[model samples]
Target: QQQVKQSPQSLIVQKGGISIINCAYENTAFDYFPWYQQFPGKGPALLIAIRPDVSEKKEGRFTISFNKSAKQFSLHIMDSQPGDSATYFCASTASNTGKLIFGQGTTLQVKP
Candidate 1:
């Protein structure tokens, strides 16, 4: 129930196009939702996050759409660029533990 599953192991987005990825979880106890962006051989960086209380959250060119009842969430990258061509991970955790359960990882390729 602590697992957060993400899909589309890979994606191709043209420059200036929107890149989308989906994730789902079975645990209702999870309250924190975070998305991480990673480049080759680099650590994941927190791009954006949202709490269960909010239906959506956005930061800069990144946005997260969440559905509490459906136990699902997604990340949308607007105006994608070559720099945005990296792996994206959707994660979640309960209130107590600081540990995050991550998705399988999505490789996004944005052509210039």
Candidate 2:
């Protein structure tokens, strides 16, 4: 109940295509859902996020679709690009805990 597991450890998507990645968590107490985008040798930055009160959130080319009942969430990169090629991580934390638990990570390669 304290972990988030992601799949496809790595992915290859064509430029201008849609890139999708999935993740699952066991803890129902997790209230804040945040997806992070990280470039090589850089710290993860908040790309987009949603709270249990909302079902989905979108920011520019990035979107997060969340399901509270299923304990699952996913990241969708619309019109992916070689420049968008990087690592994506889904993270969560309980309301009061400032610490976030992240998935293993998904390395997305958007080929030009």
Candidate 3:
């Protein structure tokens, strides 16, 4: 089973600041990396993603970066707002099995 380790169980960011969360994977076989965000009482939603072929991917205020050699990745939230406060999760998956291994999770609070 593949495992993912995430840092900073919780984070506090000011509005219009940047929020960063990191994850490291144990298996080299994992090919896809994605970050999910979930609000209170809501299901996790795909925020951004990166594959082995790309070093980084950005969508609006969200960015995800991949380091293939290090088997690690990170999610950055730019111009973070109070609405951005939520629980973030980093996950790894292989193309074949399609099994997602998720990190412990990080709760972010974007203060105004």
Question: All models: lDDT?
Answer: 0.95, 0.91, 0.92
Q: Candidate 3: where is the Cα deviation over 4 Å?
A: none
Model 2: CA > 4 A from native = none
Q: Which candidate is the best by lDDT?
A: 1
- Worst lDDT run of 10 residues, candidate 3, spans 92-101
lDDT of 2 by residue, 14-59 (tens): 9999999998999999998888889999999988888888888888
* RMSD for each of the candidates: 0.8, 0.9, 1.0
lDDT of 3: 0.92
Q: Write the per-residue lDDT of candidate 3 for residues 1-97, one digit (tens) a residue.
A: 5789998899999999999999999888899888989999999998887889999899999999889898889999999999999999999998888
How far in Å is the alpha carbon of 52 misplaced in model 3?
0.8
lDDT (Cα, tens digit) per residue for candidate 1, span 1-112: 8888999999998999999999999999999999999999999998999998889898988999999999999999999989999999999999888799999999999999
- Candidate 1, number of clashes: 0
